[model samples]
Target chain A: MEEHTGKKNYEVDWNEYLPGVAIDCVIFGYHEKVLKTLILEYKETDFFALPGGFVLKDENLDEAASRVLFERTRLQEISLNQFYTFGSLSRFNPEPMRIVMQKNGLEPTKSHFLLQRFMSTGYYALVDFKEAEPIADFLSDSCQWYDIHDLPSLLWDHEQIIQKALESLRENIDHRAVGLNLLDDEFTMRELRNLYETILGKELNRSGFHRKMVNSGRLNRIGKKNTGKAHRSPYLYRFNT
Target chain B: MEEHTGKKNYEVDWNEYLPGVAIDCVIFGYHEKVLKTLILEYKETDFFALPGGFVLKDENLDEAASRVLFERTRLQEISLNQFYTFGSLSRFNPEPMRIVMQKNGLEPTKSHFLLQRFMSTGYYALVDFKEAEPIADFLSDSCQWYDIHDLPSLLWDHEQIIQKALESLRENIDHRAVGLNLLDDEFTMRELRNLYETILGKELNRSGFHRKMVNSGRLNRIGKKNTGKAHRSPYLYRFNT
Candidate 1:
């Protein structure tokens, strides 16, 4: 707890940040066929939020989002797509955030940057769940993945952020090869379908889905996976790199 | 010129605006089979910019964007999709904006809100070219459409904003029914294909494009369009309701 508080003491050049702009990332991962998001719990309060950071003065919005993602997940070169900019007036409901800051021994009046209205741009990235190592920021107690269907009480408008991110993901599933980011280098066709079903929140017809997927030309028929299950093993495939 | 300057005198509560957040819209229209974007020429300078406005404290970002669009185009109930948020430090680039303001008799020192850094969220809209009526704002001399390929020198990062909007539009054309917004309610398949090619910046094989369009199941055959040209007329179609 002391270490976390001390980490916040490092002076940030406030001028380098745009007063009213921030970046919130919705990092979606597929684990055990369940869609999850990376979240952080504040050290002194029970408030949870999407892993986010303010845009640096010299950085582009996308670059800022990538920096936040890398800082949290320790993964580089992962692509992030901008989906929506959340700028509702009530988005920065400061009561909970103020409480968290007070509990962390920082006065709300002194932290001008935190109290100002923030219009956050939402950037989402799909990453392999097994490869991501979630690390909490200095102000947070723990960083972990939560099932999107059963999320904890989130701070600010993070719940809405997650919902919008999910909507964007579902709408873009076919248009973009997003599943490739969530799956392994090689996976069974069944695994791929399950991943889609999880994100889409609906079951897809097997034969129709298979035919459509094959015709999409985004996948390559790789070698078969030898699973020790009962019947004949399903063929494995990977994204056309 | 007097009327334009008088319009800017309407008292707006600067404190009621979010300190540094703004919205810029790229209103895209297709005319004469050439893609064009709505632009405004500042009254005091030859510089042009996307029709943009600051975010009111009580308004959502989308609402602000919609207001800007409606104020400029005089159209309501049109949907605007957000593509990206431009937050680069140099995005404001005050020199040109300052020049325009001074030329309009606005003292930059007195206009606190205008001089501050703004992180603007970019929203784009596809509109039927014939239906839209572009109007210049208080500080602009004219509001008109310019062919995207032959755009004039624009203010700040507006050129970059338009480029990003075009990129987003091209990528989402197949995924979303963007053509529906840019075309008349009922149009021929050839008109649809031409619209696609204009945005995509390339020609497509006629037969293959027709096959793909038909397979997409987004269009409904309405009737034959009597073009009155010497050749055979083509079938008219409308988007599926």
Candidate 2:
């Protein structure tokens, strides 16, 4: 009975402990035989980060995620999926920020204290670069897409968040094709092949890739793309959606 | 320049104004034609609840979740997918737990005050009931599975958590299956069918379901069930895992 009472006492004490919660975005776009991720450089703070925003009083989680994506990307109809909620209490520090905080003579107390104790919800999206006009909202100086394999030192554990999102995307690739969002309305078969090869990190047989794409019945074959050379033109395809 | 400083001040204040983070579990199991979930009856407390625990200081969020699951059900080796995070300040009681506090004759101080200002990460898993031998658990009553569609009244926004988990499960069904944990190594196709029907809330055509199951190539057909009925015994199957 005493043991049970002690457990209850602990719960009672922890019940009132208030901690901060924030949301981060991991937006991926595929281009140039490389899987790329959109990251932001904070203008005033000089912090390179993912596009993120706080939850509002009247917003649902899905709404909050959508608002963050739409507002930052300036994309009207892109869909953002809530992939993971990172509450490890350690995901807040994206490595480089430690140096920035120290160099700025800002005792890590102000940033570290709240961050190490807080939880962050991670949302990711795939968007067509042609549609997604990157807007430098909030603290951002600019938003740019970097090759996933070669990312600049990011602030906090944002790189880890990107890696996790890519892993999830790879596992669910057969269920839904995400690279459709990274292309224009019409794209060449070569471009599509490059996107898959980049994400899967293996060179797929060209014929086999085309066969699977055609059989998947999710793409509409369009007119050919002329290379303006004597070479055979590659057919263009658009997502059926 | 003054406005920029004011904006910086707002950003600083924003960190201080965020809500606290918490974790919620959507523990699902299969029973009858109704998909069931494990919930707890809180003793000396007004409502029944899902077994939940706070993320510990020294542990990762996943570790904390597994600890909570093991402590409640005594079931280990379960992998939980962290999918959604709910962050509605109104999710907590808009008013204080005034009646409950009054009943317990406790004063509501700021330190002790409870409002629904939580950002809860949702972790969901499937656990075999035979393995889930609840031990040293906090529940006042035996942990049992209640039909998810017809769940008992629960505290906070637990109902929403379960609803969202089920929706995620349905959306991702083609990529993953959940209820194999609840069944034995060998199960009749009928048993599998029943599980799917319950989750999907729709009766599948028997032959079509069987055909698709076989086509998926993820199941191995074993011998027949030794039922003493005149009708042909249904074939047993095991997961290819």
Candidate 3:
């Protein structure tokens, strides 16, 4: 706690961020046939939270979500959608925030902006699982990926945020190529189906799933037909950009 | 102006409402196979806008949207979805707001709350067009449904708001049963398909659309099969509640 509080990076500049509003991200990645999300464990406490940050006065909301995700995961190319804004009187408990401030070596004042109730706008993105290297913020000790079904104790309505994000992601699958970002640039149809199965939390039929994806006109088969399966290797496909 | 500003309803009690946040709704309705949305005409100006309102300090975002919609349409049973949040410096211009205040017989001071920047939460709802009676707010002369394709001059970023709402509505159909609300308690399959076509803004293959809807397991056949197609009436469906 002493080490964390003494760090200069922990200080917040209230004037730079939008007052009474913030952005939180629910970053999804597919791995081991399970849907997972990034979570952060707060320093010097057992509290855990989703990656979140404040929007600057001059910046737009989407840009703020991207910035927050990048700050935590160092991944900038991930596409994000502003799904929903979560503002409820029940989420206004200040205990977790108070602990965060004290751990950062700052004594809370009654007028501190950090203690004010925030109407956080929720944004979400799907990233290639192997690509993101989670980096915790000053207030957090570690950032790591955890299965959506098995999460640690979440802080301040984060469980609800993740639930909303999953629902939005399910709705966004067609218009937004969310599954594409969850896999590498070149992946086999089998791998793609696995990703979808993980995301939707159910198994899909083989030929039906393949036909639906092919008919959607969103997939492009890679490698030449004449190449002949390259020693039994499955045909690779990439989402049409 | 004197007639409007002198009214007590126009006076805002700032302490009771949340600052820096508001809700704007795009209420969708179907008529004559065309998608229509509710629009408001500013009291004394030719400018038009979507029906919108402020959120009370204790009210949740969804509650605020419902309250605002009920206030204008007098329809409380309408179901709503929080699709997106619109926040950008480009949308914060104060001229239109100044005109709105002034038309309501109030002068805009340099530091008036209405003149400040606000990040609006966008919500969309589908309502039975014939059932809803549009009632304008104090600052608006009339609230009426207009064809989405042939909207009047919209104020602020309302045009973009409507576009976003349409896309969200399309995405929301599978999970939300949004088209159900645009119809009465009971409807025939052809009428449902027409609503779907209007909402999607495209013509779908007849058999394929019908098959897909039936297979989705969301629709239930109304009236017994023993009741033959009386006078060539098609089998009706009401979404399974």
Ordered from best to worst TM-score, the candidate numbers read: 3, 1, 2
Instruction: TM-score for candidate 1, please give it.
Output: 0.84
What TM-score results for chain B when candidate 3 is compared with the true chain B?
Answer: 0.90
Please give the lDDT score at residue B80 for candidate 1. 92
Q: What is the CA-based DockQ of model 3?
A: 0.64
Q: What share of the true interface contacts does each candidate keep?
A: 0.90, 0.78, 0.71
Question: Which residue pairs show collisions in model 2?
Answer: A93-A156, A93-A157, A94-A155, A94-A156, A94-A157, A128-A181, B92-B116
* Top-DockQ structure, candidate number: 1
* Model 1 C-alpha lDDT per residue in residues A59-164, reported as the tens digit of each score: 7778888888988998889999888888887786878778877776767885567777788889899988888999988778888999999899998899999999
- lDDT (Cα, tens digit) per residue for candidate 1, span B32-55: 689999999989687888898887
How far off is residue B71 in model 3, in Å?
0.9
> What lDDT score is found at residue A227 in candidate 3?
47
RMSD of each: 3.9, 11.5, 4.3
Cα deviation of B48 in candidate 1 (Å)? 2.3
lDDT of 3 at A180: 65
Q: Write the per-residue lDDT of candidate 2 for residues A1-241, one digit (tens) a residue.
A: 1121233321333222333555688878766777777788765566777877655545566666777787777665667777787666566444554454455444555445323445667877887655667776533467888788888887667888888888777766654547557766788888888877777778899899999999999889877787875368888888887
**Whole-model lDDT values for every prediction:** 0.83, 0.67, 0.82
Report residue B155 deviation for candidate 1 (angstroms): 3.3
